[model samples]
Target: MPKANSALSRRAFLTSSAAGLAAFSSIIAFRANAQAAAGELLMVPAAPNPHGAIERLFLLHGDPLAGPIRKIVTESGNPVPAPTMESGARRVLRLMHFNDMHNHITDMHDKRGDTHRMSQIVRRMQETRAAAAENEVVLLLGGGDDHTGSVFDELLGWEPEEFVADAGYRVNSAAGVDVAVLGNHEFDRGAEMLRLGIEKDARFPLLSANVHSSAHIARDRDYTSAAVAEVKGMRIGFIGLTTQVDTRIGQPDDPDMGVASPVEAVRNVLPALSQVCDVVVILSHCGYGTGQSRSGKAGADRMIGEGDFDIAAAAGPLTDKPVVLIGGHSHTRLNAEGLNPDNVIDGVLMTQAEANGKYLGEITMSLAADQGRTGWFTHVGLHPIKSRDDRVAADDPKFDTFEKEDDYDAAFEEAHVAPLRLALQSKLAEAIGTVTAGDAVSTATVEAERYVGENALLNFMNDALVKRSAGFANGTVDLALFNATAILSGVAQGPLSFGDWYDVMPYADQVHIATMTGAQIHDMLQSNAKRIVRPEEADALDFSGFISRGFLHFSDGLRYRLVLGDAVADARAEDITLHGQPLDSMSERQFRVAFNSYVRLGGFSEAWNGKAIGAGVPGQIQGMDLRGLEYEESGLVYRNEIIAQIRQDGGISADAATLDGRLTVA
Candidate 1:
């Protein structure tokens, strides 16, 4: 643990006493001294009501008895009073946070993730800080995933003259981000690039407690597990956690680096942080659930064993101080409108904004030392920062006045956001080809109907992959397969721009050709069948409730019929065919399959029985042995290959993207 602004430091006291006393004795003495010193800095409540108060508050959130969290209007709203009973003067701390920005720096006029409106968000944070009362402290925190997605992420690949690489870091630095947690996408380009990006552009420290790295990210220099900041004589401690799923992304060059269970990591850090700081905040990128929500539904928001719920549950027993977890990775908008009951878990107040600068999360907390240890959330607000067209008028009269508030500053936009926008404009607008007019491949519908059957967009992408992979495979590519979630968006029936395709598939994943036996293929398809949620069995909302995972969409040559059943495991994929011939599951017949690097590298985890899934488990692909798989990387990005095919054929039409009788869910 780093030395905090306290009278006695745990590390220092332990080290000084180590030589004079036994190891166990030294630790006990150090704790005794630390506790004595911490008592003066932070008071433990006479009757700590962590469990009872939080449970009651969570169950009755927004109800008058729970002291409903009120939204603050920037224009005219008065400061909210402390919800807890205060015996003396109360101090306020306003915390603002956002996550999963994903390098969305461009102005997407019709989209929700655009960071063009970032200037307004920055202005809001600045105004809040400046207007803070003498007893109030305001802070800006980032929940991670600040990079990846959008054309801006490919600025290094584009090699533009302006040298706008790592735009997310640059933007965060310009926005005056005080602290941020490390996200999985930060490792998408490997540890070296991540190190370079952080070193070159990050002004604030990026922290992760679970991540242990030797090469790219190092302790202290690159990041720290925990941090402390002093504001208006109050000490705030922060612990950062990254999802262990990042191991699937692979930082092979940094072989020593690995991500551990976030729960255990927080437990280790809490002993040190709890003794020094008045309050502790967990900066988490481990997501919100353990492969399923409290309602028992599975989706991409799950982080298995490394979610905030698990961490909070573990940390509750170890610390008596006020703890709040600001979460990301799931991109979940917790407390979207106001304080939500579901967000409080194990006595921890959780807050998360929707991904991609869509919302700015503001939380006001009151801390009072006179009434033992009293720290409680007074207000929670999520400010929508969308463009004028995307703005929806708020029905509640309390927020109606600020609903259309455009808090943009001309100087901020011109100085920080405009130059990058101008740099990518010409390249992004360049027309690659046109989508022939007709029923376009709708990404929304494709995702909605993904688990039911094959999707047009996925089929189109896989077909293009098969055609392109054949050249590099040195043999006929039998078929192509990939997850439907790989397609970020859909193409419209109009002139297609480079930006349009970038939006459709932004991940820079390469295609790989692998030989799979008929039996292995059958198993993969059967596993895909298990994830199918039929419309009759589940509602559309349930089907599309969370991000779809492990739902396979294959090329035209493959065909299968899904026999729907009452439960997930009871469902089956049968009558499989390949190129007009029945595929014998037990046969030794091998088919060369083209798939993206993500699938081959175990990026996709099959949805099963709501169990927590671990990363780097190659068995997700059924029987494909990672140790001796006969496969060759094409060294070509799947998206770029699709782009090349589009350029070669001039454009794709409705006929080319239509769903045939390749897959049928009966």
Candidate 2:
């Protein structure tokens, strides 16, 4: 067993040939970097037969070639060759797709015991590559969302460990991504940082057809043109399209001011790109549909629907493209037509994972000499990413001796992650305030919002918000709204600690207060209520879990009743009463909505229509006497009354208690 290297050699080496540059006219590459590890074997999956010489290999082709490696290619993404079922030459293209890995390097937290899971997955990938090496060669592709700089930036008000280095370790340690496009989050570090990050340790061609680097390529034009990867006598034109919505995400690590429209970017490059590669595979960071909703391709899909790129564009798909998409953000459990077909236009296949490193998109593609191909994929066999949980499984023995151990932990400051996150760990480790004795919870729970009972971390955090809100404490605002997007993964009950708070509410959204009209308030609560079931119907909904099983506990003195039924359209004026009375439409009652800053800034939740005054959420640095009052004391301040009201809402109907529970059982 070959040990994986923990750190990637930062110095870049371009393996591309510049000989055909002027002849191609538009093909470009300033630096093509694809470095090797310590003799890590790249193998292909073994053909489950004994008689045939099934080749299994993981190819280490240098950066984008100087010219197309295959005959008959398309630069326009048009003129897609007809499908050739004649599986002659037996070419099997395997791309190891990894996406949305938000810097979970260095098993400090051992998040969710994913270490064990990650090792197993990597080992499997290795074994598969080993088998294929005898015949078919696999392509390792990074789907995007590599650097989580923003998550750490907000957490520490500055850059933590060399995050880009950390991500490289993760990718390299986990068999290294051969060719990857950018995730929207990668921009969190901005251009200079990204350049600095990419300058040192990056060993692979980070391709993004749509995103142009700000720094010049020595010439008067863009530095690196989208790359076309040629694997095994095949001209696989690879273009990367990250979500064009980076400006809105606030990662800001790089200084590149704008994101060109991905659709337009693809359109601009397609003609020439088609001429360069036989098959075009778009590594898109565009998310799946709203059902997966961390980020969706409402934009990317619309771009493809316009029939702009590839024979088809698979936004975020799992299978090899006869053209298919494997998407990440807005992680959705998908395995289907990676395409959106149009009679007047070409089609595209798309798929997305369910988020947070649990699935691996695998596509087994067989290209025919006749020029066409056929493919299908499944979401099965996918497993959790590297585990981060440490208490129970600090050291997975398998990884203990892996050669890359030193490299993986070296990128990030192991000490700071723990010290910086100490406040969250312990609290998250224990069960918060218990449910009424028998309040049931799901087995194998880690996230804050997964459990189906009263959660201490959640309630306490909300309660803290409620207490700190100017309107709630002083009586200027009416009812407030703080959607659960602010919290994820629950803490086990025990001595309340800061680590618990950090883990549960890992994001950095400031508390927001707003005064909404009775109509807005009504819409908001109704949205919250629909999560009882029918998640699709709750498109704009902010809360979901089992309502009766303590889906959420709205702060005390805040309550509304609803008579819900089938279709959301049927939702009429059941009554948007506030504190035992009909909402006084004539009375200008300002509502102080307490929530994370992102919500107020219009994140996944409804836009904050500043009808009421706004106040920043309290945190650690507010200054002494002011500090104590403004400081955030993690967990809900625990007012018994608020809990009682949530309980009184009659959430549990007995049927909705268990997985089989039809409704959130009381």
Top candidate on TM-score is 1
The lDDT per prediction is: 0.63, 0.39
lDDT per residue for candidate 2 within 393-508, as digits (tens), equals 43676553333332224223343333333533443354333332123322224232332223333444344445444424434333334444344544343232333334444443
Cα TM-score of candidate 1: 0.77
* Weakest ten-residue segment in model 2 by summed lDDT: 620-629
lDDT of 2: 0.39
Residue-by-residue lDDT tens digits, candidate 1, 212-235: 745766755577666655454455
- Which runs in model 1 stand beyond 4 Å of their true positions? 1-90, 110-115, 156-164, 246-256, 294-303, 369-372, 375-377, 390-406, 473-476, 540-547, 565-567, 604-631
Q: Write out the backbone clash pairs for model 1.
A: none
- Evaluate residue 75 in candidate 2 and report its C-alpha lDDT on the 0 to 100 scale: 31
Best candidate according to lDDT: 1
Displacement of residue 262 (Cα, Å) in model 1 is 0.4
The residue-level lDDT of candidate 1 at 278 comes to: 59
Clashes of 1: 0
Worst-scoring 10-residue span by lDDT in model 1: 52-61
